[model samples]
Target: MTQHETPERGARLGRACGADGSGTAVGGAVVLLPGRPGMPLLSPGPVRALVRELARAGGPDGLATHVVQHADGCPERAVDEVVRRYGDVPVCLAGYGSGGLTALRGGGHPAVNSVLALAPCLPDEKASAPPEPVKHLAGRQVLIVHGTNDGRADPESSFRLAARAKKANRSTCRFEVHSDGHRLREHRSEVVALAVDFVLGSVMGGRWSRPVTDALAAPPPLGLRMPLASGFGRSLRG
Candidate 1:
């Protein structure tokens, strides 16, 4: 794990080198925004797995990965800080749950080339004011993966976001895991592969081929029910 020069807010940053044993500063960077009340910069479940998969893929030469933790749950500010720290390198934004929402919000930053959001927790239009992120996401290449059976954050929210992005003419994609829940541990491998492909393709100028696109759009088998595993629950308290 590597540490960055401390930011003004004293937020801790963690880094992992590329899998090819390439030096840390060469390839594109992926900045992971943590979920609510973010304590651990890197979570232990699917998020961790995704990071590992990306590292193994060895993005361009440098391919450094980073996670920024925010105690106040201010993911927007965290993203800005990461952008400042990384300078001119291409950066892909990603997050889960509340962090996913933040990633969507931060995707509009000029420094962020792409975004990967998993089960993003979007604000309810009826409950409160519309989210600020929705306004800034136009023209971004965004991919959202949500579980149809997600209880903590409704899958409808993702559907709604997709509709809005389409209306705004953003390059966006959405995938639904039929029987999966919020954490989506059962589809962990698929999620990691999809995220890596989307991010790498965006940063490396690779095409989003038909096979990958089809796999992402394909729905889960009918009545498929994968048993919930430990550490797969969405902790409301964060």
Candidate 2:
């Protein structure tokens, strides 16, 4: 892994690139962005797991992984800097929370082929609106994974985004994990696996076979189906 810090428009931009073990140039790159007050790029457990999964799937000639850490709060600008630096290399974007929203916003970039947004923080009517309009997402393969029980960021927002993307005829998929919360720490392994599969298959030309899609469509087993706790339960008992 090679680390570099360059000044971009008065803000310090930090990026780390991990080359495939083959020591050969890879055609595609996966750019992982951190959420607000971004941590050291790729330091997060989920991000590291995704990178490891990518390596295992693609082997030594697979896509190179690049993580961008933002110095300021402007995630959009951070993504722009990465786009400028990467130039023509086909890039896939992935992030969590606010960073995931930023990745969605950045998906329209001509250089970005696909996006994986994990529990993205969607724009609220009272707060700031989305950085980019839904129309900008046309023609991109987008995969959004959000927990239905998330309190910090509503999962419905992801559904809305998917709806808009679908209306625009873009290829989009939404996976809702029932009973999972904001952090989604309990479902990290499943989330990382789906994310890696989506990034590789959708962005890097890997096969998005039926089995993969089937697995993604299936809900996690964490959700519980219980009998009603009130009159319904009493009626059943009666």
**Candidate that would win on TM-score:** 1
Residue-level lDDT of model 1, residues 1-238, one tens digit each, is 2223432332554444352222344446677865776346567436877777677764434565667654454456645555555556566788888888878877877767778888888876675665444656665677788888888888877777766664564466776777778887777776666677777676655655443444334443211112222232123111
132-153: candidate 2 lDDT, tens digit per residue: 3667677777777888889999
List the candidate 2 regions with Cα displacement exceeding 4 Å. Answer: 1-22, 38-40, 43-45, 71-87, 126-132, 211-238
The C-alpha TM-scores of every prediction are 0.75, 0.73
C-alpha lDDT score of every prediction, in listed order: 0.63, 0.62
Evaluated at residue 238, the lDDT of candidate 1 is 17
Model 1: which ten-residue window has the lowest total lDDT?
Answer: 221-230
